[model samples]
Target: MSYEFERESLENADDRIVAGRAADGDTVAFAVLVRRYTPMMRAYARRILSGSADVDDVLQDAFITAWEQLAQLQDPGQTKSWLMRITSRKAIDRVRVSRSYTDLTEMELPAPERIAPPRQAEANAGVAALNEALLALPDAQRECWVLREFGGYTYEEIAEQLDVSVSTVRGLLARARKDIIVRMEDWR
Candidate 1:
């Protein structure tokens, strides 16, 4: 198994034991559980945060929420997925909250002084065009594409994360690929 899976498996076992102890009023055991899961949770939060600086705050809130609600979790084996769902929701919420506070004018600054050679500049322009095309896609299609491309998630995993069917994930991927091909053709 990959490191992520191995860590997740270990986390599940640890969570079960720690949660049992925590429920019995062992604060030290609870702390141990939080410590064990913190790294994985922060890594996932960072991935979702991308360039955001508010990830630490988001993760703190998520962990607190998870701790308060752990008693309600029926299956200890799925702790990682549960934590991830919480983290993703919190990270998205942070983005939404921060967007309103950001200055749009600052984003319009002129390009940096250092310039690449003509060929490199052309390649950069191509990448910019591709990103623009991705931005033009519908939210659902774009999300499916990003999860597959950036997260390395399989169709089944994407489907599970998005709460959709595997066939729906496949259709979204097909449509996203077709859209990219058409956009690249026009760009060329």
Candidate 2:
């Protein structure tokens, strides 16, 4: 088969088929998986890490780990979730390692000067308010909220990923929701 035909076929295939092909040593299938999941993985990492600085590195590491470990995946159908779990773990590890040092350079201010239309300005304000609220959350609660709300992991899945009890995940999410609600209300 021609390379374009093969690539198109892989692109149209479902996750299970693509994952199985990847496990069978097809780099094209793996690349397809990477293209499909990279955005979601980046977003998840950004939320969990609460910044963009290390998000790409964490995601790249997760993809490398996924490539090495793909054969161990018992269900090809669950590939997306598996990738997300890898991303969440890597992001958490980055946070843990970086907790020891405060980067003074990161504290520097950025050059800012653009103004938007009224509608865009209002939307941007809401988004900024939401981001501030998220940043104010405790790390554990933030992780739980991101994993559940952004990463789309179930409570049991989050508990396993976080190495915490399900009840703890619930409590953390509840507290996160309450705090975010109060913070957002103040923004109005």
Model 2 per-residue lDDT tens digits across residues 8-59: 9999999999999999989999999999999989877776666548989998
Q: Roughly what TM-score does model 1 have, to 2 decimal places?
A: 0.62
Best by lDDT: 2
lDDT of each: 0.68, 0.83
Specify the highest-TM-score model's number: 2
Clashes (candidate 1): 0
What are the per-residue Cα lDDT tens digits for candidate 1 across 60-152? 998788778888878766776777777766765665565422222222224557757886677566766677777677766866776687556
Model 2's lDDT to the true fold? 0.83
Q: Each model's TM-score, in the order given? A: 0.62, 0.74
Clashes per candidate (backbone, < 3 Å): 0, 0
